[model samples]
Every structure is written in structure tokens, then in C-alpha cells.
Target: MTQQDRRRIAAGLADGLSYAEIARRLDRPTSTISREIGRNGGPSGYRPQQAHQATAQRARRGTPAPPRAAVPAEGTREAEGAREESAREAEVIEMAVRAGLPRMTARVHLDLLLSEEGRRTAAELARRLKVSPASVSVAVNYLVDQGYVRRERDPRRRRDIYVVDDDAWYHSIMIGSRQTLEAARSSIEAAQAAGLDRPVGRRMARAGAFLERVSLDMMESADRWRSLLA
Candidate 1:
């Protein structure tokens, strides 16, 4: 359906209009209106206005096409962008999870990233993320493990301070680089020992070599950048 039609339907839905009423007004099938609302908003709480606004915002952000044409012609660009943004958001949350962070902890990490000075106290983070101080502590610890954050004792205050430094990404990359190089080297050596000289084995060895070299370069670059920053 057209963007305008979607917006009208959304508005009508927000006004607590019935599906039949909205369909009649928009000259569309009741099923169409029902699907639109059900797909966009949950069943228990559906807001037409909110859905319409979300649709508009998605369009403005230039969404991409979906894997399947579920909402075909229904603001494809906007929907694509929204889906991508949601995915990225989920990824960030998942990163926190893999780092042993709770959902609330993951949210706090995101808030800190967007926050000024890139730092916050346990209590502040707890309040902002609507969690207890203990939960904040857990989250902060997870971030520290992932090399996304650092904790320091605050001399003036009793509580500790968490900081996201410039080297955050570098630290994470370096850590991963070490692991990747080790794994690649092991794989290449094993492949050679197995008397595997076929195309696949040769390709694997070549890729492993490339990864090792790239890891070295990354580490060197990180060291140089750290020295410069220092």
C-alpha cells in the first residue's frame, strides 16, 4: 500500500477505530488493516498514531528491502531501515550478553556510549537504566571483560567510576586478533601435517597466513596509536 494510505490507517487505528471501520474508510480489505496493525504493533496495545509516526520515521531514514516481501510496497525503505536499526540494537545487546552482561547491563553500556564524558558511576547508571546498584555492578563488570570499559576507584567518592576510553575498540580488536592468529596457525599446521595439499587445504593455509599477517599489522597499528595517544 501507499505511504499515505498506511498513515491514514495508522491514524485511524490510533483513534481506536475498528478494523472494519478503518478498512472502509481507506477502501481496503479489513484483513489488510488488521495485518498492518498486528504486524506493526502488538495485539494487546496497538497505537495507530505511533505506528504511523514509526512508518514515517523509517521512510525518512531510507530503509532497505527486506529479505522477504512481507510488507511489500508498505514503505519498504522505512521498514528496512527500522529492521536494520533494530538488528544493530539487538547486536549490541547480544554483545553484552556474550560478555556476561544482563539485559539491563547491556542497556547501561549503550547509555554510557551515548553519554557525555563516556563514563558514569554505578549508582547513576543504575538509576538511569532503572536497575539496582548490584545489577549495574554486574553490567559494568561485563563491559570491563569485553574491553569496552574500565573501572577506577574514585578517591573523592566512595563509589568506583567506569570509563570508556579511546582505546576501547583497539583493545577489543587486539584481544580478538590474538585468538584468531592462534587458531589460524593451528589450523594451517594441522592441514599440512594431514598431507592435505588439495585446493581446499591450500586455500585454507593461504587464508590462515593472510589472517596471521593482518593480525600482526593490527597489533602493530594499535601499539603505535596507543603510543601516540600516550
Candidate 2:
């Protein structure tokens, strides 16, 4: 359920509304509302407003309930950091997919990027992604070809590690802009060649012009940053 929906349910409960009433208003099952309150708040002393406030605070802090460890460690900071980093990377992968990236591709890329060692061998990546070594190799090669990642030979391990640099997004945007500009230019040319004076052609021409301008602007900006770095 959505945060808004949760909040409304909490508010209704705080106002002493029965689960049936909340379910009716929210158009959800009464059991669902009851379970939400029971899970999020306490069973004996459930307060909707307090529950909502606590949820909000947890969100603001970017904190989730601690997961039960398969085997509890002796309070090691390193293990804690690793867990936190893994969780953060998982969120990043989710966001990337939501932003239109393929889930497996995003997971592979994010795992490589967020590793504390800064790179991962094909075998390690395959294990982490639950895929075959060949799959990991292909994904790494694709990322490398797209300039999103690089490969370095690990002399000691005799394995190649995929390295995603900090400026990956900048390169990704540049690649996308070039492709968009090319497609927009082709559309504009096709519209002009057809010699159609329809509204659709005019709209396509306008869109292409805008895209061209935007692409040029982005290229200039990227060049400026390159110069600055140099």
C-alpha cells in the first residue's frame, strides 16, 4: 500500500474508527486494515497518529526494521557496514529499474559499482547475481563496450574485474543524447522529404528541432566539464 493510504488508515484508526469503517472508506479489506495496524503499530496499544509519525520518522531517516541475522555476529562494525552498503545498493538497483533499466542489468551494474573493493571478478558477480559465469562475462563486456564500465586484470587473482567509475552517469547521458539526436534528425529529414504540410509533419519538425538544440547544448556542457577537469 501507498504511504498516503497508510497515513489515512492510521488517521482513521487514531480517530477510533473500526477496521470495517476504515476498510469501507479506503476501499480495502477489513482484514488488510487490521493487519496493517497490527504490523505497523502495536496490538495492545495501537495509536494511528503515533504509528503514522513513527513511520514518517523512519522514512526520513532512511531506516528500515533490522533484519534477523541467520547467525548473530559479535557486534562487528564491518559486518554492519557491509549490510548497510548492500541495502543501499539494492535500493539503487530498484530505482534504476523504475527509471526504465532492465532489472538484471541494473543489478549487475549496481553490484559492480557499489562493491567496497570497487570491482568484482566474473565468478563473484555470477554468484551474487545467481547467474552463470558466462552470463556475467557477457554483461560485463556489454557494459565495457558502452563505456559504463572498464575491466582491469587482477594480477594476484588472475581474474578480470569490472570497474564502474564515478562518472558513469555522465557518459551514459552523453551516449543517450547522441542516439536521441540521431533519431530526431532522421525524423526531421523524413518529414521534410515527404513534403507533407500536415500538422503531424510540422509537429515532428518542431520536436526534431528542439531535440537537436538540446543535444548540442548537452555536448557543449559536457565539453566544458571535460575542459575544467583537464
- Point to the candidate with the largest TM-score: 2
Residue runs of model 1 more than 4 Å from their true location after superposition: 1-106, 132-138, 155-159, 198-200, 227-230
Write down the TM-score of every candidate: 0.48, 0.58
Question: How many residue pairs clash per model?
Answer: 4, 0
lDDT, candidates in the order shown: 0.69, 0.68
Q: CA shift at 57, candidate 1, in angstroms? A: 29
lDDT of candidate 1 over 79-193, digit per residue (tens): 6565555445545655655566555666777878877898888887866554567777877887787687888898876779898877787777788778888978987886686
Candidate 2 Cα deviation (angstroms), residue 37? 25
Q: Per-residue error at 188 for model 2, in Å?
A: 1.0
